[model samples]
Target: MKMDGETEQLHVVLFPFMAHGHMIPTLDMARLFAARGVKTTLITTPLNAPTFTTAIQKGKNTSRPPLINIQVFRFPAQEAGLPQGCENLEQALGPGVMDQFFKASAMLKEQLEQFLDKTRPDCLMAGMIFTWATDSASKFNIPRLVFHGTCYFSLCVGEILRLHQPYKNVSSDQEPVNTFLLPSLPHQIHMTRLQLSEELWSNKETDYKKRSSKVKESELESFGVIVNSFYELEPDYADFFKKDLGRRAWHIGPVSLYNRSNQEKAQRGKTSSIDQHECLKWLNSKKPDSVIYICFGSTIHLIPSQIHQVLMALEATGQEFIWVVRNEDDLGGFEQKMTGKGLIIRGWAPQMLILEHEAIGAFVTHCGWNSTLEGIAAGLPMVTWPMFAEQFYNEKLVTDILKIGIPVGAKKWTTVPSIEDVIKQNAIEKALREIMEGDAAEERRCRSKEFKNMAWKALEEGGSSYSDLSALIHELRGLSTKNHN
Candidate 1:
């Protein structure tokens, strides 16, 4: 099915959500497409362009470079009434600001259409948050696929719940209902009332619900979805999505495992904000499977009280650890006390590298899909402490379904009397000890190791994910040929 001459040049536009969690995986996906000889145009605001520039530039230096064009559009910050340079979700933390973030995202519609007209790409690969991109692709008759930066298990449960509306029959929406089984799913999946995202409770008129509606509509009508998961990782869920949903999807991930053109083998282990050698030196000193690594991803900044509880819990475990604190202010004086026993990585940490370290045994994570997958890839069990969004559901996939994660008893964040229900130090301490020293740790560790191998195999030549990606590339090339003719 190889196209001749000009038809081989399949141009694709990747429009990811502004957040790092969403955008980073999409960039990796763009690289995958580029590696397969697809011309990729990454669309983002000027402020977010730098994040992908290094990776894009690296591809060009390779012998077989994929045509990766970076397109920068001005973020409608002022027009959306957001502060200057606040182009991403991580920056807009204040109440009612996410509304403005979506508003700014919508503002990109006209500019995106103008670019679509100029570039006339064969396909548009959009992030789940950018619902408007689906329609923009339709105007030009371009094939569009929404990229979901999560596993198939989460997606299957989410879609099943959305379609069946099982929660609608619950007696009280405000109070946490007992855990109940989802009849639609084949797995013994049970969800507590509170496990649903806080946004689900919002009225339909709210920005969150309105955006959700748009995403659902796009999911139903678009070409398909490109998920950051591999078929072997969740075979049942992946099969369900393909067979039941009746939508085309390609599971071409653990995309993090893909070699970045800029990150040479020697430089792959480096953290963004820390010196690589110095961090590696400390890790080298520790014994195998003796250290616990803790991080809560990029967006969810822990409050001072939550930070204190976590610090105390790590100390209670009495094991060597590395903790990533976003803001130094959150730790205050705690870093001074834990000097020899614990290492505090202020700002960014080399998460994937740390997880891969021989010294690292377990992870206490927020259950963000990227972090979860990274931990799995490293063959490490987890202490799940989900903060918000689909994280709670992800927590279930790890703790209950996979049986490789210990929960800290955090059901959901309560805001009635100021963000209450923070998991106390005792629960955190129990979870830490279970994963770091308890008997169950061995069982969890073995399960994690199995998935780690599967993740790697999926990316190798002739694997499920690799073949799926090739199929997707061929389909896009066909589209390009048809359009040219």
Candidate 2:
């Protein structure tokens, strides 16, 4: 399908899950398409559109104005039994509203299909949760590509574990301390059953499993999977996803680094609600690689007890720290308790900017995929305190595979209450020390640096990730050409 020396227009629609972690990376992917002269449209709800404004403005500021359109649709909040504006996962903070959020999300299907019919996009690229988009794309004879915001390592491990259920044989009582070895990995990977999410270990039926099954089915029916990972960073795992899954897959990321707004400006207007300058100034006062930056990505809700324990641990370390306080109630005047010791951002913080700062010695993270990739890009070792979802799997990658982190010894999943293992101040202190100043910290730091180099190289021209992006764009253009003829 030659273009006769003329560039044929290819329009791609990006429909990401409402979570910020999902939105940010998918937006970056859209920017990549725009950078290559592909027309892109990001379909989002009215409430979520504002979040993309700063990044969109940043794209326009650059010489080549990204042909990225912002298509906002009305959310069915009332129908879903949610408040008028509660369209996103972050806004629905309580567990009760999760079903409502999904209900609203499902309602978008009709509008999205109508939008697709009107616009006739060359392809639809959507988050894993939007499983219905595959069928929508099929109606138009268009390809629907599933975008997974995590790395190839976590994805492979998750798929393998799901199929084999190796942990199934491990007794429930023994899971608290016992380790289960995964059978068919290039490297030996072992984890306690407790390390997995509670739902995975449950014997009864769950809505989670039902939802996950749909996502899995959607992936099997989709054109391919677009993952936010780099080839050099996980060569073996990347190969595993491509070969074993028998699916077209592209490892074209750490996509956050590609957008200037995300990497350089802290995304200005669209970033944290708190002040960025104050935090950066405080970071300037600290020594190189001496500050620990702590943040849990948007979805994780920490109990007050856990928050207190984290505060005590940070204070005990006596190290300079920066913490993102999501819930004001959780702080309980801890800011005054540690006045000169650390800085606290009241709301969201510019995570990428903070991670990239030279003063960041270690990260205390929830092990979210976005945070994990950002930490790797920054070359900082971590203190992994996984809360929920694929975070525990990501923790395994960081602690076992990458060898760039120390676990905070959270024995049970935070989302469910099968058994609560309070991560004590002493355990937190020890994990912080191991990542910051322990004997193996140097090795971890060196490994982090190596990954950082590879991450950058993967994005460079002629690199693996770079080639994957190019191939994807070419394939999409060919699809459009074929559809037209």
Candidate 3:
């Protein structure tokens, strides 16, 4: 843990799931360890290493960027289910494969063993899909931690709830609509019937429990967990994870916040994504807390109608705002028509900065874990429009339970998708206006202020988040020492 004591840098190996969602956050975490003068090697499939390294290189525009000196190492993956040139874990999980998850993990374990034998690292940090990573850490006699991409509150609850058999399968009379308020927290969480209505053997059910839980159990039985969150914002939930769950958990986020202060990262050559300066220029012109930032997390698919309606609603509201429409096809002529009131960025965004901006008012988010946490850190009220996955659960927390935000347009629980589902621009306009004005707006803003204070406190010098991170490093160091002895 002492930077001064090292002869060189301590070597740490990182392996993230192949999905972009997992890749970005885990890459962010690896960047943190690397930023601290630690020598880090990001271990992944050969096919992915080049692309990831390119992204990292792009993110670290060299000249004054606080560079994450991470080396990328690729281990060969068996090409059975994987597509050509797609040697990543995701490639392994492709069609015509059964138990591909475990098989891929087993192959990775062998690859890691060979790599570690040649290039020893002090610790191993992995994605939730790398079910054998903890074991690999143990085999190598190194410290281990799993990188989680969700809000710990959401992750903890989702993992536990997944254990229960489907309540939707039971007779309506015999079943109770499932709702439980979190203990020691100020929110209630429930499962909607739509969520319950998915097929019993669907791929959704398989991914959530079979693969995700397997990864979770592997991590739990290992060293600890490293989360991208600070403790103050979700104190009760963080406490539960550490104390009741009996896991060593560290919260060192908003990771993107540190990136803001990291002048070195700003100049990075490659990924310096989207035109940030231009984006901010547009944002600068908007009223404080007046703009609605709408974006679904990457990888979500939405109908064209859904996007068109949301666009018109923003247009009808005539509110000055920044809209991050990743897919431009749905907007039609809305961007050109509502020229003065809107700004749309084509691709990736400096999301944390936008949320933290003085002029921004609300977030129209896809309810992904990363966006949700970032939004909370910035103290912005939300307009929940869950696309799919665990997002529905997160939407429940944000709207139904937290009271800090509400759903967009229609009521979630009972509303059936009508023919007018996509064209209800007035409904979108009304929802936007309500959350941005009157008593409701003031109350939500006050709540945001309360959370902001808590977030600052969590990241302060000896705060829970800092201490947890320090502890994880210390524990890993101890493991290294014992190995030497």
Candidate 4:
């Protein structure tokens, strides 16, 4: 339905949690809304203010400039119980981090009161961590929209499906919950006990039975939720989010689609971000679509044990690849560990550029939300190597539901883990080779292109995402203009 309003002018606020993954995408969304003439106030901690600004700098469409104003609100540290300079949600490291997040929420309420007192934003869109938003929004008589910085499939598993319900705080030493059922999800999408953790399951300090139980309550109550995916990508999941959850869901991604397009135009035929590897040149040197791209995302830590296993697997397989690894210090024992016919870049790679390169055939990813979307947007197939909490869920959607990626659900962060599913090294190599060079590769390419087109249409004028955003702007204007009489 079209939103009934005089003009689509809105005085909106954007508040994302202070992390690269969370803040960057929210900033892009803010830019999109601002471009559409929404008066956008983006709220962030001091640390992230610069991060968002840098992203805007990259969006180089000066002719059609960003159409919104960004406002920053700072919450006190000790009061919010966060150590000063906490850039991203530390609580994300493990379940032990939840208490800190809870404390941060209490702190935000105090700081937010001062913020609202000075400037009344029409409505608030917050990162999901600030679960106390309903209380604050109600106090100010404004709607609060919580943005889940992940795939809808992951959120559904987190929200409606309760996929982790059965293993509430079970001992890890015991057999894990591999291949569990979800309430609303298709059987093709399955999860294992390896993904479940005690922190997500148990509320150690609170009276609540589990941490996820509290998470569930919050999921039920938000005024609206925004996910960085489109309906065409996962129609069944999208439908489940709306019809079953009784809430509004807008699939406005892959967000990188709009961002990559904007940045490519801005850079104007120049290389951007990290240095371009000869990997592209090398891949071009080989036959069509012959290289594998492997990356574990920004926040993952690689201890020596983990590195050794990967080295052995590659050395045994004898396949060529391109790998990106970011670590705290220099390769501690790396020379002895990885002896394979492959190139390893020690830091960040110009991911958008590399993915767009024709030589790159398959992505071996951690399945972090951003990486997953980028892989899709660039039309590359994936070899899923999920690392943390919701990534297992995301892996299932990509490999199982979407059928564009392969799920290699090995949770062993290192090759030397005592317990593993024991898929042979040859099997792993064969899988990689098959996906990159065989009929499987072609099928994946077709599906990847299919979703990419859907994402493009959703962002263009008159598409579902475009219409949803316009409606949001229209509603915001009505709220901004009308007195609540």
The list of candidate 3 runs beyond 4 A from truth reads 1-4, 7-9, 45-78, 85-107, 163-170, 173-188, 196-208, 261-273, 400-402, 409-427
- Candidate 3: 10-residue stretch with minimal lDDT: 262-271
Report the lDDT tens digits of candidate 2 across residue range 375-403. Answer: 99999999998877788889988998888
Ten residues in sequence with the least summed lDDT for candidate 4: 264-273
- Name model 2 segments beyond 4 Å from true: 1-8, 175-178, 261-264, 268-270, 416-419
Instruction: Please report, in order, the local distance difference test score of every candidate based on alpha carbons.
Output: 0.80, 0.83, 0.65, 0.66
Task: Work out candidate 3's RMSD over C-alphas.
Answer: 4.5
Any residue pairs clashing in model 4, and if so which? 95-199, 177-192, 177-193, 178-192, 178-193, 306-414
The lDDT of model 3 is 0.65
**Candidate 4, residue 437: lDDT:** 67
Clashing pairs in 1: none
Residue-wise C-alpha lDDT for candidate 1, range 1-485, written one tens digit per residue: 44445533678889999988988787778878877777888898988887788655655666766667889988999899999999988888677887888888889999999999888988999888878788889999999999878888888877877777676666664544655677667678777667775566444566667777788889878999998888877788888888987768898988887753324222332226777677888999999999999898887767677777887887776878998877554676777888878888877776777888899999989889988988888889999988677787788789877888999887764322134766788999888888977577888898999998988988889989999998888788877667777
Which scores better on lDDT, 1 or 3? 1
Compose the digit string of candidate 4's lDDT tens values, residues 270-379.
23334444545565665446667888876666555555556566666655677777634455565455434466766556676667677777788888898898888777
TM-score for each predicted model, relative to the true structure: 0.93, 0.95, 0.83, 0.83
The prediction achieving the highest TM-score against the true structure is 2
Give model 3's TM-score versus the native structure: 0.83
Give me candidate 2's TM-score against the actual structure. 0.95
Per-model root-mean-square deviation over C-alphas: 2.6, 2.1, 4.5, 4.6
